[model samples]
Target: MALTSARGWQFRQPSVLPGFGLALGVTLLWLTLIVLIPLSGLAWRSSALGWQTFWSLATDPRTLHALWISFGCAFLAALVNVVFGVMLAWVLVRYRFPGRRVIDAMVDLPFALPTAVAGIALTTLYAPNGWIGAVLAPLGIKIAFTPAGIVVALIFVGLPFVVRTVQPIMEEIDREVEEAAATLGANRFQTVSRILLPDLLPAVLTGFALALARGVGEYGSVIFIAGNLPYVSEIAPLLIVIRLEEFNYPAATAIAALMLMVSFAMLLVINLIQAWSRRRYGYGA
Candidate 1:
């Protein structure tokens, strides 16, 4: 009888606060309301533009150029942020100096500043006759009202994301680890490449993904600097807005849907990379 009872026995644990069922229901309801519903509506709207029409819109020269400018400039900006952001995080985590706190706080100024205000400020600074632009004008370097201006705007806004994401992870690393590496006859380059980089890779990638996402979706901070010229400096988001203003809802929806799909695919790839890195490092294994 005891043997039979043991065979039939089962183990159970207490549910978390408010019970699993209620928590799941709330989570699903919130997601449906906020994310799923809106995205579904967008897809539905885009579908109204038949496949041929959608294809035409997507292949339009103006549309293609705008998309390219937006994604290309964003890619460049995120790459720049990754290099500078990692350096900044290292400095903040490893060193202590006068006014370090002030500098650290200033890194988040982009987050607090309004997007439109930031756009205006950047445009003013980079315009042909503006302060810094005046100095560069003689060198024949045009910044404002160009694609380079869009890149600059993106780099400004997306920087905080990379810095904040990497900072916490960097702080968690101990200096003693580097010291131990040095004691073992490892040169600075070897220690950094082998010991430090493996640990920081995942965090850096996360920051990069965040920065890229923000840059891709950015509109307000880009328009003023980009000059929004069709097939030249126009960004995808601005194109969408222009379509909407022209009462071309189908075209707008098609562009938005395409962006949504592309953004989702890029983020999914980044997440896969993060997962693979974690597994290779034996993290959470």
Candidate 2:
């Protein structure tokens, strides 16, 4: 009787909300309206540039430099965020102390603060004559108006994404797992690398991807601190704005399309890595 009942069972259980077809239709419609349509329109505009024009615009030295700065600084910032963000998440999850809640709340400040406001504040703190920069100036270390400044701004905006992404997953891990590893003669390093890391790898990759995406598209905060120097600190988004301001729509569209393609490719790679990590580590299993 059990075997017969099992064989008769449906693949999908009924839902209170709606059927699968209705849910999927709504999902696709929303995606089309919100995502697909805009992207398609951008591609259409870019296509009007002609392949040769598009390729030339994309390979222009100034455009290449801007794109390089944007992606490079973003990658560096995301890498920094992954290291510090993971450590911060671990601290928040594993320890308790005075001002713990306050510190935790501060992590979300970037999300709450307006981008322009954050830029102004960061500029105030890191400009040549500013408090932090003034101290570093004597030692000949410049933070503001440079690629390094862009990196700092990106890190500021992207850190929350990493911390928030990893925190919940860390919370879900049981303390007993670590204890068990220690009981089996595992040191702290071994427990973390062999036991905790495997489970955490997928989540870490997700956070890294989020941070990277945020960094790549960032504009306002970076602009205030980056000095907008051509071929030095000018970012792709800023370059697009420059093109638009100059009424060069074709050039603007070309840069935008290039950014979209590159961002999509990077995110796709990260997602593939996430999937592989899940399979290799049996994370969900």
Candidate 3:
């Protein structure tokens, strides 16, 4: 007879760590305190609003518009980051140009810079009649206090995620593989498309998911550049603040709960895509 009998479950590998159950219990307790409990409270509060009231709050015109803008802008920003981030990582890893070190360091600027400060700086430069804006203003182009500005701020905040995620993967790509592709009569485009890009897809998706999450939740950097106009440039998080300021706790929590759900769904889809790619192609495919 097998040690595990006819059960589907198999014996787990012995762990070096003592007290596995204790460790698992502690992990559960930690996760509960840090994440699950707060989310549960938010859900409970939203439930207290009743389905009808919550639906009405979530479906209000301003709220709907804000939610649309937030998701739309975040998706666009993440898509842009995927392209540019891949190119940036490729360049940084493949070539040694002048100021390469400086350029590499500068990629982390958004990470180090406070979001509010970055927002103000971006607004100053992009505002109509401001430096870059002055040039664009004559051409009737505007950026600051517009939806475009939100995309720009999100791009700034989210670029590093993509770059960093994809960089290691790019660096790990073996030069010999490219050499072999060339020897097999493949051109640069074919080699990159068939070999490099497929391998990079998983990391790119993970980076996009992370950046999308950050862009969705971003508030501090966005407010200054967004103008926070109701139903025009307003974002969902800003709307939540507006509700809170007016002491509309029910509305605030309802909106918050909706945002949480939408964000979770978006991230979940991206994660599923990443997981599928990993399983289908293996890690370095």
Candidate 4:
């Protein structure tokens, strides 16, 4: 009887082994096919060159300049997005007014617009003889075909990341908390600073990191406005393309691998912060 009862109890328990195994197999297969294969090819191609040759190519002055410019512009663009995106998200969530729906829809335009089209539009708007550019040119603020232009293109493309990431979090924030702070005689500024900012910090950082990553990898929009001047306005992605055009496959792959490593490290740090924030917040309370 004891043996029969034990068997019955075991049979009543749910069996996840088959389903878990199937899911894991499918995920691994997909990652191997879509991600691992291409990355492996890049690494293999890079390794074809001797290690010294690879190191020389990656550390060349021009290559280093391009990398520096790419990261600097991406950092600045992401910073700009963090400030304005938070304000935009706050307005969209906390206020109700005419044309609010239209404004909300427009915030997503960057996401849907073709990157090339966005680049072209920005170039046209900022070009010397263009309508907006014509006015600014008189003031000595040149934008098109400059490094500033590259930062502008990146900012245009990355804005949606910060806005979208923060918007939902702002919407879900409890109004009661703010009201409680207010009832305790906290002013609007104090209430927002003390009650709202802490809760929103994680989402803000996540958005900033995402925008930074996108800006770092951005090519289509930046290429049009950057002028592609080597060691000047050229970005790392464009440099990679130029290397490929020159048939320097090993050099291109080496640069790509380096960028991938740096980006991965940054993403890992951002994810750790996000996890820690979530734990502090106690399951999005």
Candidate 5:
């Protein structure tokens, strides 16, 4: 963009790129209509409930438990994704093996599969009588219908976000840097930690936030496997649905508002981390 002097004031010079103003206008118009409008309605409706009532509903034991399970499991799953997703991205980018393309495509199956179907399939696989669960049951392990089951479900849905986000960044990294590190007498671990990981940090953080956000709002894929025991495996999103189903609009709005605020805060933190990484490493910041 350039500035041009016009009538004692400076204005942005128009670019050859046509429709810049129109494009920006359309973008903002859609953002306001599709995103801001609904969010505004949600907040307004929640605010209609008196503060005391809203507080009571938000602080209810079941609601508290559900929120905890939702956030805690999502955080755990996101952390796991950050670790394994990076490794998977690394493998896909750096290695060539048989069935590589097939495995790469399989990573996106969750994206195409309906969440409800995913939930049922996962539940079937994790039920005590199911093959994997049957083997674990003999060892006194149980997953289905528990908090662990929620985490598992979340991990399944969230993995693709991390893998996809990090893979492109990994591919963009120059192999010459790794070779330089090796020539500098840095071992493999040192090379990865000092060079590649630093450069990938921003993308990793982005992927983690996306995964966490998705996990927080997950419902269908969790309900079947969660066993939905009031305070045990219930998620905040499910609680909101339950409230809505009972015609408790105010309560539902309040819970939805809470999740919205929390998710926003998380995204803000992720953005901050990305900025810091870019500044520190001179790549993504």
Candidate 6:
């Protein structure tokens, strides 16, 4: 009788295993088609260049200069976003000023605005005779068609990532903990420094990492503003494009592969830091 009861119970249980397996299979197949396959192809094409050729292409002086410029501009942009994005997130979450909702919506304008359009708009606004550029020309601050313009374009593209990532975390932060810190004789600055910041650090780092990653791969907005002058304002992506246009497929793939590896390594380190922060704060898995 016990055996029969067990059999009946087993029969009544829902068989979701097949459905779950089907979904997992579909997801893997989709990812392979969209991402993995193309990346694998790039690696394969680059491998045809042989080690010596690959090394020479990647280590070329012009290539090195472009890499340096790309990394430098992206780093500066991400750093700026880290500061302003956090402040914007804090304001949106903690305040209820007039036009707050409108301002919050504007934070995502970069995401909705086409990259080319944004690039053109920014270029026009910062051109020598343009409104903002007219004021700065007297001070000798050239923006459009310069390295500074690259940083500006990157900042424009990356700002939304930091703001969006930190905003939700800030909104979910417990107000009671802040109140408790205040009640314990901690001043406003002390309360924020000791209580709020610690909790926000993980989210802030995640946002920074995301912004940095986006800035590193940025192309559309940057090309228009960068002037594409080799060893000067040219970026890695533009170099890759130049190589392709010159029919140097192997060199292009090699440079792209190098960029991929470096970006992956940097992102891995950032993710590790984020994971450690989350574990320390008991916030993420």
Clash numbers, per candidate:
0, 0, 0, 0, 1, 0
Candidate ranking under TM-score, highest first, comes to 3, 5, 2, 1, 6, 4
Highest-scoring model, TM-score: 3
Return model 5's CA RMSD, one decimal.
Answer: 3.3
Q: Could you give candidate 4's per-residue lDDT for residues 195-219 as a string of tens digits?
A: 8987899999999998999999999
- Sort order, lDDT high to low: 2, 1, 3, 5, 6, 4
**Clash list (residue pairs), candidate 2:** none
Model 1, range 72-175, lDDT digits (tens) per residue?
99999999999999999889888999999999999999999999999999999999999988999999999999999999999999999899999998888888
In model 6, the Cα lDDT at residue 187 comes to 98
Candidate 1 regions exceeding 4 Å error are: 1-18
Candidate 5 local lDDT, 183-272, one digit each (tens): 999999999999989878889999999999999989889999999999888899988889989998888888888888888998898899
Quote model 5's TM-score.
0.93
lDDT of 5 at 137: 93
Clashing residue pairs for model 4: none
> Which candidate ranks first by lDDT, i.e. highest?
2
Better of 1 and 3 by TM-score: 3
Better of 3 and 5 by lDDT: 3
lDDT of 1 at 61: 89
Clashing pairs in 1: none
Task: For model 6, give the 10-residue run with minimal summed lDDT.
Answer: 9-18
Residue 170 miss distance in model 6 (angstroms): 0.2
The TM-scores, one per candidate, come to: 0.92, 0.92, 0.94, 0.90, 0.93, 0.91
Tell me how far the alpha carbon of residue 107 in candidate 1 is from the true structure, in angstroms, after superposition. Answer: 1.4
- Estimate the overall C-alpha local distance difference test score of candidate 5: 0.90
Alpha carbon lDDT at 225, candidate 4? 85
Model 6: colliding residue pairs: none
